[model samples]
Target: MSKVTQHEATGLDDLDPATAPARDAVHFRRIVAARQQVSDAEDGLREAVQAAREAGDSWTIIGAAMDTTRQAAHERFGRAR
Candidate 1:
């Protein structure tokens, strides 16, 4: 696979970074906030997985819900409980 440059990802090949320091800063801040939100969501997902296990849900069902394989789900979250 080839690398996708920031301009490619954002479809802004003409974007001028030097002239957009404030906009870049805002984008960086938003990225940080989004990462934190993802972390929180992951924690919630782990808790939900544990709760589901406690409720007699099998790894297969959990995996199906998560769009993953049973082994993958078990490997990732089985130890949470």
Candidate 2:
């Protein structure tokens, strides 16, 4: 497929306001859905981390994999401790 320039891609340079609204509605729905997915993923990760900590995994191991310090992990997810 060919790449579109910014104006061509958005159609903002030519399209009528009425036409833009419908297209914008679809974009808005996608934005909302993407945000929802991010929130869901965060919740899932929180649950998984809690479960792992509860299972007796060391904070050092978890923090290293998370690219954070053990103290930071405890501060963030220590409720499971």
Highest-TM-score candidate = 1
Q: Would you list the C-alpha lDDT of every candidate in the order shown?
A: 0.89, 0.82
Count of clashing residue pairs in every prediction: 0, 0
Q: 1-81 in candidate 2: lDDT tens per residue?
A: 898897897666897877556544788689979999999998887887787888989989878878999988878888643
RMSD of each: 7.3, 10.8
Q: Which regions of candidate 2 deviate over 4 angstroms?
A: 1-23
**Which candidate number has the best lDDT?**
1
- Per-residue error at 49 for model 2, in Å? 0.7
- TM, every model: 0.68, 0.62
Residue-pair clash count for candidate 2: 0
Query: In model 1, what are the clashing residue pairs, if there are any?
Result: none
